[model samples]
Target: MKTLTRKEFIEQVGIGAAVLFVAACAGSCKKTAQGPSSVNFTIDVSTGNLATNGGFLVQNGVVVARTSSGSFIAVAATCTHQGGTLNYSSGSNQFVCPLHGAIFSSTGAAVSGPTSTAVQKYNTTLTGNSLRVYS
Candidate 1:
């Protein structure tokens, strides 16, 4: 067998490294681009009476009262996994993603995986009859 030159060996290794990098990036890029599906409308906050344990979907987010402590919290209704919108479950008092059954607490904590990230939180303040949520 003939001895391989240093330049030839370096060139082969470089080509192999480039192919590995491209394949790795291709797989991860698809995941990063994934997000919640879009909804065409927004929820009217004024109609959301904050009297009891009422929750409402305003625009693409949700405003909910976790307790009688007057603690109102807002979070994105969009799922972090495959871009599914979550519905407010008054019975369970949690956000339920219909797509894959992922659950989240009223405070946006991830109750389950399938989605390893928490729902995006929104800033909220009660403005008279309307709940103002920052975009």
Candidate 2:
């Protein structure tokens, strides 16, 4: 049988620890990037494609949807359940999380989902072509 010397064992342990450290770092780094906890921004609704009804835009991790009635709504793009990116369904007027089928209403209310918590909503102001959304 082969036995490792004390010095050799120490070197192997150090290498193993380094490998484990690198692996952990890589795993943690692969997480989905989250947006700012708080948002404050203004958008020109008149100039961009968002001017039309049912138009939606994602900026700063916020989803701004222009409803069919020509009104603007803003909600956090991240899903409350699992931080999945959200999409607006104009046909249903709801936000859907692609991760786990979580659904939210236009008012950021939790309609149906794995999570009972509602997504964060932002206040919006529309004046002429300028639209402001803030948390």
- The TM-score values for the models, in the order shown, are 0.54, 0.69
Q: How many pairs of residues collide in model 2? A: 0
lDDT of 2 by residue, 1-135 (tens): 789999999999999999999998986754332335678899999867588998898899899999888889988898878899889988899999999999989987888979777777888998888899997
Report residue 95 deviation for candidate 1 (angstroms): 0.9
Give the per-residue Cα lDDT of candidate 1 at 132: 57
Overall local distance difference test of candidate 1: 0.64
Clashes of 1: 5
Ten-residue region with minimum lDDT total, candidate 1: 33-42
Using lDDT, give the best candidate's number.
2
What TM-score does candidate 1 get on C-alpha atoms? Answer: 0.54
Kindly give the stretch of ten consecutive residues in candidate 2 with the minimal lDDT sum.
27-36
